[model samples]
Target: MKNILKYMSLAFVGGIIFASCEKSRPVVYTGENFVAFEDTLLSIPESSAKEDANGETQAIPSIATIRINRGSGDISKDLVVSYSVKAKYVTTDTLGNEVILGDVPEGNFYLSSPGAVTIKAGEGFAFITVTVVDNDQTDGNKKLTFTIESTSDASFTIGYPGPDKKAKSMVLYIEDDDCPLDINDFVGTLKVEDVAIVSTPLEHSYLVTSTQVSPNSISILGLFDPVTRYPSPTPCPAPVVLVFNTATKDVIFSPTTQTAYYRSGGCPATTNPRVVYPDPAVPNKFNTCQKLFTLNYYVRNPSASGPFDFVYSTVSKP
Candidate 1:
């Protein structure tokens, strides 16, 4: 009986092994061949201005490359893909409401050969190029949409899974590069409004004169003197300068270690306050179009103990 039991266990183990070794049917790709856009949304940066050899500043046009991809198909034969462009595209917002984004004007962009790209033999991808025209006028950012209309080879589908998929269309955002930094705009008289105060309260509204110190920097001559509780001299003994970032529109105090006086409780007499962004969530930036400065910073006396004061200020051009 013991020998019969041992043989039965061995037979069961062999049966399990045989079942595991048996191969299942292979997964066959029954879907048809298709072509689709590599990306649904794309951005083209604003054209930049460069000095030519003749000493003339010229605008360099921005180019955008749109890619088409082929899936599950023999790429040995050349395939011609045709696309259509529209001024606007219809999309849904977060609330599921339909939104139309067709802001691009007719003269803002030039498409090469009316949206046709050829996937060469033995290649699975092709590209179409669009040249963004720089009008040198600040008209805001624009958008254009392109849709895969048809193909020279009818055997391949318009989009990967189906023509109705998101890959069948692409949206191009052409950013504005027309706003060039002019240092003169930051010059003249400006008003500094203290929106939020920390430690000692400064003036509610103060007038300061700004002079262009450099191409991208300016000196504010009449900044409030924290020590004296009054406006500083015309030529400030401790110069207060603000530097502008041309690309990002960010403003920062050049000499970040400037000293100021605070007389509030738990604070020392003097403090070296550095310029910093008030909130990490929102950007500390200068609006060139509106000529506004939104800034946030802290004034802390290192010699003091406990909490320090946070200052929120806005400088605007009158």
Candidate 2:
């Protein structure tokens, strides 16, 4: 009787250890990329792009999305299942800032809902995972909304099948949208006075060389001339030095930043003219346009982040 009792205790301890190891088993969800492996953060072109004068509204990609994998590890018959998805971006910046990279959306993707994993009654661990979207819609009221959601849930192991290998299949699933934005009805007479720096291949895009600031939407200054001296060399009516916030889209006539104020100056007269600052989007690099400003421009963005910068988009008086 003593021997039997000792043997039973040993079996119990062994069973407990096995159970603990079993609980810590990793669920391998085999997944693939949309096009390339690096496509984890795949970028789409502009949902809507318009050609100038003769230009028409054309399509450009601009959505980013992904899929999840659920493997049928050594299982036979399909097992009942549910799954949850989680995803993240590679960069520290929030998902949308016009200049910052964008996010993935489900509206234009073909991610399926989760279902069951198949396995025999004696079979163990068969998982099926599908699609999840982490969408950061670029720019929203100057604040970005980075969201990720799952179309499924994780599953529980039912039983175990005889040891055998299995494989699962996956495919790309993203489609372009017809009208993601209000680019259809809201047409403003934008005097695309100037197209400033959008890309600088050889420099950091966050520094401004020289910034001029004053009051009254000073962010619209587009002068290609030099600031004059006062006293003996004073220019007529004293030119109002214009200033702008290349970041934050802030503008002020008196040196405030990112506020949209009606430009109040022009070249020569320098009054009531739009102001364009040195390109802060790219530092240590010079843009072809020495001057940048828009006239008769109308922007339909409910928020102020949207600026009109089409080249020759509007007829210029000068």
Predicted structure 1, TM vs. truth: 0.42
Runs in model 2 deviating more than 4 A are 1-61, 65-237, 246-250, 255-291, 295-318
lDDT (tens digit, per residue) of candidate 2 on 168-270: 1222222222222221111222112223222321111111112223221222222221121112222222222333333322222343122222233432453
**What does candidate 2 score in Cα RMSD to the true structure?**
19.9
Instruction: Give the TM-score of each candidate.
Output: 0.42, 0.25
lDDT, residue 235, candidate 2: 26
Q: Specify the poorest-scoring 10-residue window by lDDT in model 1.
A: 1-10
- Residue 276 of model 2 has an lDDT of 30
Top candidate by lDDT: 1
